[model samples]
Target: MIETVVFDVGETITRDDRYWAAWADWLEIPRHTLSALVGAVVARGQDNAEALRLARPGIDVAAEYHAREAAGRGERLDESDLYEDVRPALTELRGMGVRVVIAGNQTTIAGDLLRGLSLPADLIATSGEWGVAKPQPAFFERVLEVAQAAPARTLYVGDHPANDVFPAKAAGLRTAHLRRGPWGHLWADTPEVVASADWQVDSLTQLVEVVEDARRSSGS
Candidate 1:
């Protein structure tokens, strides 16, 4: 049985509407241009680091990312940013004795921001705190450790194919591709990435059904 539901932050769980725009503005690129770059990165099955190089050659990606973070790029998240279905789904999962965790590659400030929202997750972990980020197996490995879950018994839900679905699945967790965020819609049509997800949903309400079906299929 899948005992833990690990969710990607930023766009998957909480809506940090200011984030992408902030990054784009910092890079002196229009938000639409940055969005296009993201789509191209996803279509090519590339990681964010590579996307950074492609976006601007000879650029210090890490330095710029930190600069963006220091500026509070989407650092302020609240209940208002959450989709209507988020809390109910989380509550339902917890009530079923399932653990819900917000696990994602986010800025260091994200931990505090997420915790402040009281989103009903049993744990909230960010890449900054872990000293590693997604698309790397190490990140998910720590997630499993924190959840005290076997990889196969965990379901990772996210909008990014490269950063979330593929990497989490590679680490042996079941994957859910939630289609609404930029990466979700941009890479939605990418054949292989879409095929990698064991489940896909349009909303958090649909996630409950997916979880139930998965439980049945797992015979637990």
Candidate 2:
């Protein structure tokens, strides 16, 4: 049975509109241009940060991030940023005795903001705080550590195939690829995603059904 659900923050439990819009505003570029560049980067299987570099060549992304913070404009998160289905799905999973964890490649500030929102999750963690990011075995190791469950019993859910599905599968965690965001929809039917993801879903609510079905099949 799936005893724990570890989630990726962006485009899974939360919508990333404000996050990218903030970056575009900080860069003084049209939001559409940055969005297109980000899509291009994702299509090319490059790091998403490469989009910012494309916008401003030779730019130090980390430095610019700090600069944005110094100017009183940094990563922002609140209830509005969360996907509507997140709370219901998490609450249902927790009610069913499943541990719900929110872990993703995000900044410590984003983690703090998420905590401030008081999401219905057992834990909320970020890459900045953990010093490891997605597609890293160590990162999945951390996830399994916090999950306190066997890798096979823990489900890692996200929207990115390469960063979320492939590595989590490599780490022996069952994965669910949610086809909600750009990266998700773009690669939803690709052979790699189809082969790697244990379950493919369109929403968090659907994930609840996945767990229920697994429990039923496992006689848990």
Top TM-score model:
2
TM-score between candidate 1 and the true structure: 0.82
**Per-model CA lDDT versus the true structure:** 0.81, 0.94
lDDT of 2 by residue, 1-220 (tens): 9999999999998898998899999999999999999999999989999999999999999999999999999888888999999999999999999999999999999899999998899999999999999889999999999999999999999999988999999999999999988899999999989999999999898988999999999998
The TM-scores of all predictions, comma-separated, are: 0.82, 0.98
The alpha-carbon deviation from the true structure for residue 133 of candidate 2, after best TM-score superposition, in angstroms, is: 0.8
Evaluate model 2: give its TM-score: 0.98
